[model samples]
Target: MSAAYRFSVSIMPRDGILDPQGRAVEAALPELGAVNVHHVRVGRRVDLEVEAGTEAEAWTTVDRLAKELFANPLIESWQIESQPVTARMGPPK
Candidate 1:
């Protein structure tokens, strides 16, 4: 049986890139009784799962998704990685 593979893609702007939304969130953290957090920038995350015959193909698909779907393609760099999966046997009925 072909195993199931999972991929997680995290998209974020490079350092020194301006993020108004992230700054807003950081500023508001104090209002929630949370402090001591600094230099916080926000990004997006996309989770995808597929059963592929090969690991190479799984990586390729994720790259395409990062370029065409998740990232802006102009001002963002993305990181995509495959997670290891080990099957756990359930109780036999």
Candidate 2:
């Protein structure tokens, strides 16, 4: 049986890249009493599930998916974090 793995993809703009949304949020932080917040870069996390026989397989699947759909390699970068999903079976009813 294949195991289900949950993977999280974090997408962020590359260093020295211009992030207009991040800039806008940073500009508003001071007015909201978050003066200490600096260089606030905004990013996104996407969670996905894959069924595979091994961790390598799951990672490979997620890597391809992330590059194809989650991140734009030209201006942004992505990282994948994953864990196995545990399902507890109760006594047969």
Candidate 3:
């Protein structure tokens, strides 16, 4: 049986880019009584459970997927983290 791995990807807009969502949240913070909230930026995280033969294979597959489907290199960047699954949770619900 193939081994299962968990991958987490973080994608964020590059610096100096306009972040409308972040701006909206930042503006609302003052009203919510949040103190000293500055330079707020918004980003997305994606998690995946994949089956692969080995850790190296899993990393390679995830990296390729990230480049092709996850991040827009022109305006965004991505970070990837991965680990082998020792126990089965029977997929995410």
Candidate 4:
């Protein structure tokens, strides 16, 4: 039987790569009264649900998607965190 799983995918630019968004945020922070902050990097989180017979199967599915579609393998790296869903929640109103 397939069970519902929740996955949180985090995508970020690899270290040493130029992250313009991160640089922009870092520049703005000091002007906004924040100090001593450095090396700020911007990344994204994607929450998704999958149904599969086992945790491995669900991981494989999301892993493939993250590699092939979600992240740019050249400049970005990705991580996945998964957990079994005890109960499903309805969409936000």
Candidate 5:
């Protein structure tokens, strides 16, 4: 990840969330000729574009942000990764 500069932080639940949208979709599945589906739940992905000096710093910034804001430490788990920089995308110095 050393060569990486820009990072995308993805925050989502590790267990599950009871989603009404998912349930509605699941309920409709059987009528649409799809069956045997015992479980269905919905999860969302949050991508954060952040600025940092180094790859390590980028990871650290997002990690802290996730733990502090995006994720609820009580229920969900999250992960992050850095993307390859094609060209400078952050605010110009």
Candidate 6:
């Protein structure tokens, strides 16, 4: 039987890649009294659910989507985390 799994993907710019948004945030932080902050990188988190027969299958599905549709391979990288969903913790009806 296929099980529901929750996946969290964190996408970020690859190291050494120029991140204008990150740089802007980093610069603004110091002005906001965060003087010790440095090398700040702004990234995005994607939360989703997948149905598959096994954890590996769920991971594969998310990994494929993250690589092909969610993240830019040339400039960004992504990490995936998964957790099986229990009946008691299922999504709202």
lDDT of each: 0.79, 0.84, 0.82, 0.86, 0.65, 0.85
User: Candidate 4, residue 23: CA error in Å?
Assistant: 0.4
Q: Which model, 1 or 6, shows the larger lDDT? A: 6
Residue 59's C-alpha lDDT in candidate 2?
Answer: 94
lDDT-best of 4 and 5: 4
**Candidate 1 lDDT tens digits, 22-44:** 89999899998889888887899
Give Cα distance to truth, residue 1, candidate 6, Å. 1.4
| Candidate 5: segments with Cα more than 4 A from true spot | 1-4, 16-24, 36-39, 86-93
Residue range 1-93, candidate 4, lDDT tens digits: 887788888999999999999999998997888888888999887778888898889899999999998899999999998744643356632
TM-score for model 5?
Answer: 0.61
RMSD of 1: 4.4
List TM-scores for all candidates, in order.
0.78, 0.86, 0.85, 0.88, 0.61, 0.88
Candidate 3 per-residue C-alpha lDDT over 1-69 given as tens digits, one digit per residue, 9 for 90 to 100: 677788888988889988898999998998989967899889888788777888789889988888889
Distance from true location, Cα of 68 in model 3, Å: 0.9
Highest lDDT, which number?
A: 4
Ranking by lDDT: 4, 6, 2, 3, 1, 5
Instruction: Give the least accurate 10-residue stretch of model 4, judged by summed lDDT.
Output: 84-93
Question: Which of the predicted structures, 2 or 6, would earn the higher lDDT when compared with the native?
Answer: 6
lDDT of 6 by residue, 1-93 (tens): 987788889999999999999989987896799988888888888888887898889899999999999999999999997744542344574
For model 2, how does the per-residue alpha-carbon lDDT over 1-93 read when each residue is reduced to its tens digit?
Answer: 787777888999999999999999999998899999888789898887788998889899999988899999999999998754543233322
RMSD over all Cα atoms, model 3: 2.5
**Model 6: C-alpha RMSD to truth?**
2.6
TM-score-based ranking: 4, 6, 2, 3, 1, 5
State candidate 4's TM-score: 0.88
